[model samples]
Target chain A: MVMPMDGQLLVLAQAETGNALGETAPTIEVEEVGEPNPLTADEQELHATTEADGDAHHSDVFPPFDATTFGDQLLWLAICFAFLYVVMSRMALPRIGGILEQRKARIEGDLAAADYSRKKTDAAIAAYEAALAEARAKAQAMAEETRTSIKADIDGKRAQVEQDLARKLEDAEARIAATKAQALANVDEIAADTVQALVGQLTGEVSQAEAREAVSQVSKE
Target chain B: MADPNTVDPIHQFAIYDIFTLGDTGISFSNSSLFMVLTVGTIAAWLLLSTAGRKIIPNRAQAASEMLYEFVANMVRGAAGTEGMKFFPFVFSLFMFVLVANYFGMVPYFFTVTSHIIVTFALAMLVMVVVIGYGFARHGVKFLKLFVPAGVPGYVLPIVVPIEVISFLSRPVSLSVRLFGNMLAGHITLKVFAGFVVTLGSLGFLGVLGAVLPLIMAVALTALEFMVSTVQAYVFAVLASMYLNDAVHPSH
Candidate 1:
């Protein structure tokens, strides 16, 4: 397909160049009778060179389709590709793979470290909470113990005060009984004196012994 | 029809001798030069960028690594872990085609992959490896690739030939796809660019008229870039899939 197209292009280029040359030849011939045009000569040269280049390229053959060049292309491709394969497989690829692997390993290692740090932080938090709970429990237990000890001391003091109060009351009641008896004896003597006074006032001091004997006999009864 | 003097679209595909190889018909050519350039570019990019091997990648290093992993994953995905053995081969093919395609995008640069022979050679290499490795690994069982598991006996006569033909066409399709895309794209771009040049010479109005083609050329350039990369990826993917067939031929 490309071969035919190139052939057509070649024919067209030749035809166009031929027409240009044919047209310019008359112009140049006519101009030569007067003065040769430098610009026209330059154009002629350009066309000639282009035509020559077209011919050199094998006007009928497309470059890609040119079977003659295949050997060189293949040879060079083999050399270059083989060199490439070697360079890639041995040098370039391995290094790249290593870089990738190293990067992956590094990323994984970093991730794992981060995970470990997170775990350690979690453990620390757990330990802290455990210690906090233990301290709180210890404080609660100490408070309970102090409360019990203070209550026991207060109870003991209250019991001792009650016992002392009972003993004091018993002593006071005994003393009161002794005083009452002495007061009753004094009452009897006073009654006897009053009776003696009354008797003295009435019938003289002769009655003192009689009044005392009467008061003593009445108390005994 | 373009004036051959002003715009020879096919002129770009021409291979001229830079030097000769001792009277042998095999002379080094522009195609060869571009091939070397391709190789050099790939090697330099990969080697120089990864020379740092920093855990945190710079842009070039990241790009290279992305390419590596992309091809690696492609091989592994298509052919499985066992296909990783051919990772280097696939990587080489991918980079070669990719870099060659990109190189072609440079103005006035010879496109190595645009030639049928170059792409065909690369495809042949892939097929050779696949067929060779398949037979070596699986022996006569490699023929089982043509015989799918669930096909009925009667249908196999039809299915088997189709499978064989498809298998045979792998190189053809692979090579032609890259060659055709590169050739057509370059030519189209050249023609459009030629339009701008041809039209712009006419006058101010012609210059104004050339804007459409100029825009088209620009858009085509971007599209060509995409096509180049995509074609390379396609070639690698197909190669890996074919390798998969070689590795596990039963399917």
Candidate 2:
């Protein structure tokens, strides 16, 4: 058992003396001066016969024990407990508490960071949505402008085609009218010639006056 | 060292009884002395080690500094960096128990470790304190220490009782491991030493037998020394494990 330093030494010294110098020796006195006391007859026999490593003075540490009572042991245990509590409260717990408080603060700091991140994330999401809406509006306007320009281009192309078709149709009608006038002129000329010929034939057959009248009437009609 | 046959076993085994209080009894013996010594030794060690210090450590300061670092790292590694919060309590418990165990192993010193009562008391203390800490930290949520994740309602009938029993058995198992190891080792040593005496009284054959036990005893003593340190460490580690469970009840 671990004894108090001052204490075990005293018990050890007494045990050594009794074993080495004999319990019966009269001249031996164990001085506190760290020297072995003189040995006596009975002590010398006990020491020699044992043949124990009697050099280490503390070898006499074994003391008699009786196992019946426990009041003192309980008292010692209680006292030791008190010491333990004191050390725990005064030194150990304070260091532990400081570390714990530091940890709590660190956790709170992280939570605050998470909160800040959430807010920042919300702002980023809002800004992205706004940009998306603005982009949609711009695209819609651009599409509408393109559709208007395409409609204008189609209208211009249709008007140019219609003007070309009308010009061709007018030219075709003028040609047809000219051909009909020429045919009519030729027919009238042919009829006048035929009448003249017939008058000549009648005069020759001795009917000049009647033939002349028929020709004039035919010409007039 | 007495002859095995000549000496009375009861006399040799008798532990000193110092007092009586009515129906109660209190004994101051080798065991009691060691307990007192353990407390004193721990106090002196802390004080002397910290007596003179430099901002940047010298040898003595470095020694204590290493102890602190060792314990801090142990807490961080076993419990997690978050375990640093429990650094002080766990460190002190480790140092105290380890030192006490070492002191008990000294030649001719009465080993308080070989007793179940002492070990159980320590285990119970850790169990109680850890539970209390959990309650303080988590309030009603401390009940989650046993209710593991993903257990369905149908399974709760069988699982809850089993978990509760396992939880309560922590102190018993922890104490028994330490007590049984220490007690068995010391008893083995004593028995082997007895054999040396018994066999040595014969002639040459006796001497040969005695030689074997002598060798065995010496070897076992060395083994015992290692076991003592390991047991102390085991106790401390278990304490930390229990604390971890308490803090992280989700597990």
Candidate 3:
């Protein structure tokens, strides 16, 4: 509120405060304010002679500063607010979303790699076991083959030796038979000679037939 | 008649209330009508001005471009590049407050800003939004705004509380400054004006006094205009500062 033409300070006109007077001015210019900005002498002398008598000054009731009663409700109707919020969240948000999704995917991809590593190791382990098993089976098969070949060689050598021994034995048997036959033939001749000798001692020489007969009679006696 | 507030400076404003709705207190006054007028004017200006935009825009489009650039440069300059994010908010604030203030000087329309209800409301709204935004973005980190950079171990008992008080008083001081400036300016304008009419019949001295008051009235009006724009800029800049504080609370 503005100051009055009179040289009095306003006593703050109020609607309901007890200390405040109504529309009417208070009795005496109480601490009156005017061109004399209660703070200065130059302003005071400027309006020193304006008001006369006991009136001293003319003052108006000043309004109190109502901090509580601030702002018009209409100004804050929040008109179009919902639409603005939606625009900001929807249209504006999508532009910056790539980073968030990328970060999530990167982390998830790392996790997937970690998980995949286990499976890979397990597969490699299985492959390694399979390779090891194959090697063992191959060695066993080789050893078995070596055993069977050695046994076959030994059996072939034994069969050859048996055939050679049989041949030798047969030859030996033929030789013995020849020798015995020769000996028997010689015995007869020898016995005939011995008988001839005995005859000579007694009476003189005998024929071969007579000798064989004498040998035979001597054999009988 | 002798009351300081006897003459309402804006009474002559030709805008008037056409009717009232059964005392529902929802009566649309001249001021309310003009507020709508301001909003519509801005909308039309934006739409029509930008209707046929081109790479090298025509006059209408250029006008829109200038306005946009003006707000952009201001935001960039005051709030830096980071402030660009709040361009829409600052731009809207400037347009609304600028229009209201310029229109208030139109010799008839009521200055909505002259009322504490308007200025304080805007201040509080900004505060709530800024605080809400910081919390939404950084959660509890916003509380660090009250924490100072350095002090002493012993001073914590005193410094922390004082800093907390200062932070809490932000909205109060902001609203009060704007409200007080507008209110005081209008009151001074009204007071000087009363002299012109009341100094009647004092002859050449009266004429001389009337002339001095007239000159002062014009000068003050020009000053008020400057003040209106300044206040809007200050309000916008402070809002940016608050945002910066939220972004870098430890600072």
Candidate 4:
């Protein structure tokens, strides 16, 4: 499409050039006055020399004096400038601006997300700390309760053992006392028998009551 | 191989018809060719670079983006954010001038911006646009630009004329500055290049002497490159400044 249009433009430009030359030829002659057909004779000779230093010198760009060329330059500059301005304003700039804006928004979005995630992490840490602290406190209380109950159970068992030991000792002591009394009574009887034997030997006479009374008196003494 | 006597540095600026209509001196010349070249190159660049329109910038995209940002910053700095509406214009003008200036640095390429008429036309366009914008937006208030903000009543006459003259001179100064920079730099480069050609034709000893001019040309070429870029920047900056005045005309 563009190629076709360019070709069309080329044709149009050629046609326009023909018309322009026809239009400007008489004017160029009138302007020169001395050289009517300036284009004919010296054209090849001038081409032979690179400088073409005969009549028309190179246009000095320093002085902005050439009104004719100025108009032409301005005409083209305007067209070119307008074309550029349109491209820049309508197409190029907006695309760039869009990319830049999108990038900016993306960056801001990422930053915000980061901030939110950081907050979430902070909350999680706080929750974890709180839960850990609570668990520690519960464990400490449970330990205290277990220690107290265990101590009570041990105390009750120790007291029971002590009472049993005391009871056994009392029974043994009572029995020994009874045995001692019995032994003392037996000694009286034995002593009376001995007395009777001795009496019998001496006079052939013995009494159990008297013996017992005597044993009692001896035990009292 | 050409005659050194006939070596005309200013001949590079001559206009010749590409295809003659018959005898019209005014036909599509080298200047026109380069102008079209300038337009085509820029258009292709902008179109191609932004074609993919990726979020991550490629080299061409990055270059275009950088240029955009640079021009955007210039407008924002000079004219504030309001001046950004003129970004496209300023950017176009800057790129065109910059590209044309750089194009001129090529050995045989014609420097379009070297012509005073071209720069003046651009400057006039800026002036026209600014004035049009100012008047369109501000109405009669735009004329207040000629009035100094805090001038005494007795000094109003003197101050107003001076302000008006300065305002009128804005385009002239802007155009002349860019035109002068490009023209001078290119001419200087040409002169040095001419020196090399002229001196080298003499003999072996002369060829050795030509080395000095060749070095100078190389150095001047570097300077011209800088000048080209700076002039473009200055033109854009000045345009923005003028546009700023339009947006916010101080009485």
The model with the greatest TM-score is: 1
The count of residue-pair clashes in candidate 4 stands at 3
Computed on alpha carbons, the lDDT of every model, listed in order, comes to: 0.81, 0.64, 0.59, 0.77
lDDT: worst 10-residue window of model 1 chain A: A47-56
DockQ comparisons of all candidates to the true complex: 0.31, 0.08, 0.01, 0.34
Local accuracy of candidate 2 as per-residue lDDT tens digits, A17-44: 4434433221233233333434333333
* Candidate 4 Cα errors over 4 Å, as ranges: A1-64, A173-206, B20-26
Candidate 2 yields a Cα-based lDDT of: 0.64
Q: Total clashing residue pairs per candidate?
A: 0, 14, 10, 3
For B1-251, candidate 4 gives per-residue lDDT tens digits of 16774566666666554543344343465677788899889989988998988888899999999999999999999999898889899999999999999899898788899888899889999999999999999999998888868878999988889999999999999999998888778768888888899988899998999999999999998999999999999999999999999999983
Error of 2 at B11 (Å): 8.0
Model 2, stretches more than 4 Å misplaced?
A1-75, A88-221, B6-14, B18-27, B55-61, B81-85
Per-residue lDDT for B37-120 in model 3, tens only?
A: 655566566656555544446787666666666776777776678667776666666666667777777764666566554666
For model 4 the local lDDT of residue B206 reads: 88
Model 1 docking category: acceptable
Candidate 1, TM-score vs. the true structure?
0.84
Q: What is the lDDT of candidate 3?
A: 0.59
Tell how far residue A197 is off in model 4, in angstroms: 7.0
Point out the higher-scoring one by DockQ: 1 or 4.
Answer: 4
* TM-score (chain A only) of candidate 3: 0.46
lDDT for position A161 in model 2: 86
